[model samples]
Target chain A: MWSWVAHRVTGMLIFVFLFAHVLDTALVRVSPEAYNTVISSYKNPIVGLGEAGLVAAVIFHAFNGVRVMLVDFWSQGPRYQRQMLWVVVGLWVVLFVPFLVRHLMHVFA
Target chain B: MSTIEAPRTQFRRSRATRSNYELWSWVFMRGSGLLLIALVFGHLLVNLVLGEGIKQVDFAFVAGKWASPFWQTWDLMMLWLAEIHGANGVRTIINDYAEKDRTRFALKTLLLASAGLILVLGTLVIFTFDPCPTGAATADVPSFCQTR
Candidate 1:
């Protein structure tokens, strides 16, 4: 139940992020100065931390997405979905840990 | 949270309906979700990791990427897929939570309208981007432009 809720929440959050991203990026066609100014606003520590949250959401959504695909596609997969969810969690950690180290270092540096 | 009006399970649709729309929608969500991870990660890898990260993402950086047919297609897919996926997801949520048919219809209409507008604009700009417009100040241009 939590996984389902998390997936829905993360999907919505990423969609919101995508909308904001496109709006700021579209500013390039309007005025480079405007675009640069908006993009740089993201450089603030608050926004950087928000970006970290964005990264975590994306990572979990993507990994759990794969597990969802497997459950839908693999033979006998739905029968073992609980285990598959655990596998998704394991993969998320493996993929996220290294990226988090470098990403946070870059963000705070 | 309102016991005044009970939440809906789904839009008024027969469970035994022969149409495959919901099935396709479910498949699309999983399929598109898989594809989005690749497209999104590749995008982040190039835009945030390849160079100076977000700081380097300026007019010239954008101009350079849109210059390629590959990047244009990549972005186009991301725009369409993510918007459709999100809209569908929201439609599902609305069907679940909305107590009134009119409210559900209104919200879904708003969702699709905005998604459609963004997709149309995004596609147009990606394909027709003018890297160097005449009459623009050189300082405002992507530094690579010489005669702007």
Candidate 2:
């Protein structure tokens, strides 16, 4: 159940990011100056936080993806699925902490 | 005395069918995942933390960065890795859960469609990005575009 939910959620998150990215890039067609204005808005501290959220989502999706792959292809994976899930959580914390710290410093300092 | 015979089911098990596609997919997931960690973080760091941070990001900003082969390659790698990784992951899910053959087929069809669409669109955007437009109001264009 968790796997199904995670799959759907991650898919949606990735799709959302892709949509935003495409739209942002399309701005270049409007005018470089206009594109610059939109890109500049990304500089905001709030937007920085939002980007961090995006990073987190991507990490989760990727890690959980690996987990799903293991279960699908390996005979032993189901035995360790729960353990692997925890490891993914651990890995996420390890990766995210430094990223968050650096982002905060850049935003506030 | 009576002799009894068992009937074979419709789904016959093939003993000799072998394909390395799954193995390659597995390897790709791990390899691309490791690369994604670095590429994604570096992307964030450069776009959001380096120099004047996100404020410096502009049309000219992208044009300047993409002007160099390094950034273009970086972006191209990221796009390919993430798209392939995510698509393969979804494929695994569809195989695992979608028991009905038609359902699995439909789901995978959709996944492939979306992935292919995104990949082509993204690649086009990255490679064909026009830093300068031929005709535009000067004030509405970046200074760099004017010079080109």
lDDT, candidate 1, A14-90, per-residue tens:
87887777777788778767777787777766886787688788889898888778878999878988998888788
TM-score of chain B of each: 0.83, 0.80
> lDDT per residue, candidate 2, B61-109, as tens digits?
7777777789989988998888887788778878888999899999989
What DockQ does candidate 1 score? 0.52
Model 2 chain A poorest ten-residue lDDT run: A10-19
Estimated TM-score for each candidate: 0.87, 0.70
Instruction: Extract clashing residue pairs from model 2.
Output: none
Question: Docking quality tier of candidate 2?
Answer: acceptable
Docking class of 1: medium
With a 3 Å backbone cut-off (N, CA, C), the pairs that clash in candidate 1 are none
How many clashes (backbone N, Cα, C below 3 Å) per candidate? Answer: 0, 0
Native-interface RMSD of candidate 2: 3.6
Best by TM-score: 1
